[model samples]
Target chain A: EPEVTQTPSHQVTQMGQEVILRCVPISNHLYFYWYRQILGQKVEFLVSFYNNEISEKSEIFDDQFSVERPDGSNFTLKIRSTKLEDSAMYFCASTKGVSGGSSYEQYFGPGTRLTVT
Target chain B: AQSVTQPDIHITVSEGASLELRCNYSYGATPYLFWYVQSPGQGLQLLLKYFSGDTLVQGIKGFEAEFKRSQSSFNLRKPSVHWSDAAEYFCAVEDRGSTLGRLYFGRGTQLTVWP
Candidate 1:
């Protein structure tokens, strides 16, 4: 079975530095998403990307966050000037952009743990 | 605003005992519910999902979840759980009315299995 894969499983960065988390979604998937889970917190949606554009974003997805599908398979999330609170496990997910059938199921990657000190 | 509520914070069960994890959601439109499991320091693994048709949906790893519209609940159940079943479980709902596939996940329930 094809699955989503993320690079740099663990990252440590300074608070003021920028970080980029990379993900390679399933080849045929059309919709991609980014979610984050702070320790002891719920997984919150950051943003969704489709057609190489952001479809929707949550309040937490502020100016510091941006997503890009630079290539056919590569989807990335960049955080500029990270804060200490930004440390968390970031997950990348993708699914076929369809309403009915099994396309709605989102396959998640192993996740990249971001730690800002 | 869509949200998922997993009431129980933690649960413990002996090996071979039956298991059930509760989940509730508040959504305006038809809800697409799913249950996912995550072991310690591991990624989320989809256990099952409920789309349209039947209320009772079967998923991988001998797990099943029932969607009760009246209660706004989608609870996951297992007939008999093994020690390996101990993990954190999350219930999520797909936001089909708004975004392409943005998911709202619950706080999650931690399951501890005794051998």
Candidate 2:
């Protein structure tokens, strides 16, 4: 089965440095999403992207965070200034939207583990 | 506020034993429920989901879940589990109000299957 794929399975960066996490969602999928899981914490939604624009974002997705679909296949999340608290496992997911009466089942990538020091 | 609760933090079951992972949700409207599994070094994988009609929903890998609206619960079950079934399981509820479906996930339950 076709699946979402994320690059740099593990990322380590300095506290003040910028970091970009890359994902290639399933081809033919229309809606993409970003979610993060702090160690021992619940997975939290970060942002959702559709039609090259953000549909919704959470408080955690503040000024430092931004998402881009630079190409037809790539979805990227960039953090301008990373903090210690920014360290977490980031997952990318995509789904065929409610359009055409498709069920909203999000297919997830293996995730990129971000470690800020 | 929409929230998902997985009451069990961890569970251990012998191979071939039946298993059930509990999940509860607090949502205002008709809720969209889902169960996901994460193996070590892997991302969350969809196990099953509950949208509407026929409270009992069957999913991949011999797993199933029941959505009980009255109880506000969507619990995952496996009649007989294998060692490979050991993984972290998460329960989530979809936000209906958002144009893009946003998911609220639980803390997750870690399953350890003994050989």
Candidate 3:
């Protein structure tokens, strides 16, 4: 089965530095999403992307954060300034959106563990 | 706001024993429910989902779930669990019934299967 893939399984960066997390969603998927999980905590949604634009975002996705589909296959999340609170497991997910039908399931990647010091 | 509750934080079961993890949700409308499992150092894996259906949904890895609308609960069950089934399980809800919507996830239940 095809699955979403994320690069740099672990990332360590200094506070105030910029960090970019990369992901390659399933080839045929149309809707992409970003989520984060604090250590030993529930997973929280960050943003959802479709058609190269943001469909929805949470308060955690503030000014310092942005997402890009630079290529047809790559979806990237960038944090302009990393903070201690930013350390978490960032997961990339995708799904084949149902067309005119009800809906389909979303798949998640292994996630990139971001550590800010 | 939509929220999910997983009452059990941890559970231990002997190999080949039956298991059930509880989950409840607070959503305004017809909810879309999903069960995901995460092994150590791995991402979340989908087990099953409940949409408009017969209420009893079967999923991979010998897992199943029942959606009880009256109780606002979607609990996961395994008739016989293996050692490999030890992992963290999460129940999530998507109120919008689509991937475009956000998924509110429960805190998760950690299952430990003893050999």
Candidate 4:
């Protein structure tokens, strides 16, 4: 089965540095999303991207965060300034449809572990 | 605002034993419920989802979930769990009609299958 793929399985960056996490969603998927899981914490939604624009975002996705679909296959999340609290497992997910249809299942990638020091 | 609650933090069961993980949600309207599993250092894997129609939904890995609208719960169950079933389970909910759909996940429950 086709699955979402993320690059840089592990990322280590210094505080105040910029970091970009990349993901390649399923080829046919329309809706893409980013979520993060802090160590020992629940997975939290960061942002959702569709049609090259942000559909929804959480408080955690503040000024420092931005998402881009630079190409047809790549979806990237950029953090302007990294902090110690920014260290977490970042996951990318994609689904064929938006809502109330046959395709509601969101497939997730293996995730990229971000470690800030 | 929508939220999910997974009451159990950790559960231990012997191999070949039955397992059930509880999940409850707080949403104003009809909610789309889902169950996902995550192994160590891996991403979330969908087990099953309840969008509409049947209350009972069967998923992969010998897992199933029952959606109870009255109780606002969707609990995952496995008839016979093996040692490989040890992992973290999460329950998520999304609004049925929301345009900008985003899943709200629970804290998750860690299952440990003893041999």
Cα miss at B103, model 3 (Å)? 0.9
* Predicted structure 2: lDDT: 0.94
- What is the CAPRI rating of model 4's predicted complex? medium
Tell me how far the alpha carbon of residue A7 in candidate 3 is from the true structure, in angstroms, after superposition.
Answer: 1.1
DockQ for the candidate 3 complex? 0.59
lDDT of 2 by residue, A1-117 (tens): 898999899999999999999999999999999999999999999999999999999999999999999999999999999999999999999998682133668989999999999
- What C-alpha lDDT do the candidate models reach, one value each? 0.92, 0.94, 0.92, 0.92
Fnat of each prediction, in sequence: 0.72, 0.85, 0.62, 0.74
Candidate 2: pairs in clash:
none
TM-score of 1: 0.95
Candidate 2 vs candidate 4: the DockQ winner is 2
lDDT score, residue B48, model 2?
A: 85
Higher-ranked by TM-score: 1 or 3: 3
Question: What is the per-residue lDDT of model 3 for residues B60-108, given as tens digits with 9 covering 90 to 100?
Answer: 9999999999999999999999999999999999858544867889999
Number of clashing pairs, model 1?
Answer: 0
Better of 2 and 4 by TM-score: 2
For candidate 1, chain B by itself scores a TM value of: 0.97
CA RMSD of each candidate after superposition: 1.4, 1.2, 1.7, 1.3
